[model samples]
Target: MSGHSKWHNIQAKKGKVDAKRGKIFTKIGKEIVVAVKNGGPSEDTNAKLRDVVAKAKAANMPNDNIQRAIKKAAGELNSVNYETIVYEGYGPEGTAVIVECLTDNKNRTAGNVRYAFSKQGGNMGSTGCVGFMFQSKGEIVIEKTDSTDEDELMMLALDTGAEDFAAEEEVFVVTTAPEDFGKVREALSESGIEFLEAGVKMIPDTYTEIDEETAVKFQKMLDVLEDDEDVQEVYHNAEFPEGWEG
Candidate 1:
């Protein structure tokens, strides 16, 4: 499968999210509580919980926050009932888009998400509308240098479990099944591989390349959704132009 960075549009917003420690903690904290409540806090037995724990650590959420979320989920402390919602739509130039959210109030969250889309010249679609256009996978990003050879990575790591591996502008994007992500990550860590970021994300099966004007609109649509309190992830079938790769 081919890959597109679209990094020029996404990097600034990622940096903004990184700066909001409180927002990051709140989102991951909710995930931890839900994961524990659903499958218990034992990562050894709970794969979903394990993923959330890893996400919490990556977000720099405090130890106490993680523990408290677990305790709350286990009934040792009070916990709120939060629901997971997936909103799908079409963005600028009719790009397929999907947004994942966790919220206690579905009505408010739904309204906000719909409004965000409409505000950016997009429209929300029914559930499962655009979901079929994407595939779910676990992805890891590692910087590329002469020291890390592509053939070596494919043979040592990708061959073992990774579904695909690609050399981006200056980084290697490693892809794996969701179930194998933890094992692959552990192996990479033991092998002394340095990584930038890793997570489970949905990759578009087909891409819609919008003109520059429509690309700006699409970026705005993504940003609005990302800024929402309930939105966890916003994905689209929009690919970056060749000129934007570097």
Candidate 2:
């Protein structure tokens, strides 16, 4: 994969979400509830739930909020049904885009997503239209600190089943198979290495370089989709011009 990993984009948004703490928590809470409904509330027995808990912790979600979400999910007679849906589209400059959403009302979510695409000079496409342009993988980000040992980190990642490793400008990005993500993360944790972000993501196989003008429009389209309550993630193959600050 060229350019930055999806983890980088998500990390950039972390700061923005920090200011809107409630919004972040709400999104995580919904995921937790969905995990509970899919496979009981016990993190020990449910790998998905465990991953969600880890994600919540990484986001700095309060312990109270986590427990409350689990407790409410455990007690619900008829849980809120959130179906996972993937919407594919083309962004400005023919950038392949994918939007992952967890929505109870597919019509509403689809309408909002389609509107965002149309309003931003893009067009929504049929399912699987752009999905083939990306591959699913586990991505982990670790900030470069004074104590970080580049060689040691690389060794740890390789020994722990990481498939690829890259040193970015501000952080080390580790890639692994989706199934190995938890094991790799656990090993890193035991090695006393803290991660800035870790999750499964759709990584583009190839990049489509976009000019400043197209990048601006593409970013606006992303913002519109991200601002929606149901959109969980948005992936794209856009590689903005070098030194472009997004």
Candidate 3:
């Protein structure tokens, strides 16, 4: 943990993983199903479902697939029920990791996740072991080109009781109190600023740093977590050096 890069350049060059579309679709569908089952099918009434729909649209999921997911989630069609779970662990160089997932097979996911950590030079820790190292908050990313100025956004978000705000390289990161997330998101929308992404995420209290070699290994661990259809997000308390910008 000599240095840290909280923001990794995730835009590295690579061929399209379009072949993973089916895997992505299956993961997204499970998410929609769980969201609908927990909160109901109507997007207007179910905030969770609304967010899931937004995510599906962002990912370019087919309308038919979306409709079918909602149907299955509402039990209008036969499908296995899923539950939301979070896994906390330590990665290479003691980087804290939090993984969010939706799965019907808890045991299977736990085994898979643990195996990935072990093979990747990390170890899975007890639940809440690393959770305390992060805070759960709603995050929305808006483009820098938007006419919305930081001062204007700060005032508006503060008026709505937002927790924190930061203007990053290409986007603004707006953090909101968990309960006021939807309100903040809507207010931003009404202001005509387009958001790139919105969701609840775990932001680390502090970031640990590893050498370039270890950082690449940690990145591989992240790949393993994200590849799981059951896994939704993998939050780490590791940061890369700005110089290590990929």
Which has the greatest TM-score?
A: 2
TM-score for candidate 2 = 0.92
| Residue 135 CA displacement from its true place in model 2, Å | 0.6
Where does candidate 2 have its weakest 10-residue lDDT segment?
A: 1-10
Q: Candidate 1 lDDT, tens digit per residue, 26-134? A: 7777777778878887878987887777667656677788887777678742447889999999887788999999998999999999998898788999999899988
lDDT over C-alpha atoms for residue 215 of model 3: 77
Clashing pairs in 2: none
Model 2 C-alpha RMSD vs. true structure (Å) is 2.1
What lDDT tens digits, residue by residue, belong to model 2 across residues 1-246? 323474443333555667756766788888888889889999889888888877777677888989999999888828578889999999887889999999999999999999999987899999999999898988888889888998889999999899888888788998999999988987887788877677788998888888889878887888788788999888888877666555
Using lDDT as the measure, name the better of candidate 1 and candidate 2: 2
Q: All candidates' TM-scores?
A: 0.84, 0.92, 0.85
Alpha-carbon RMSD, each predicted model:
3.1, 2.1, 3.8
lDDT of 3 by residue, 61-166 (tens): 8889899888767774345767788888888988898889888899999998998798879999998898988887877666677566778877777687677777
Span of ten consecutive residues with least summed lDDT in model 1: 1-10
Clashes of each: 0, 0, 3
The models' CA-based lDDT, in order, is 0.75, 0.83, 0.74
What is the Å distance of residue 51 in model 3 from its true position? 2.6
Ranking by TM-score: 2, 3, 1
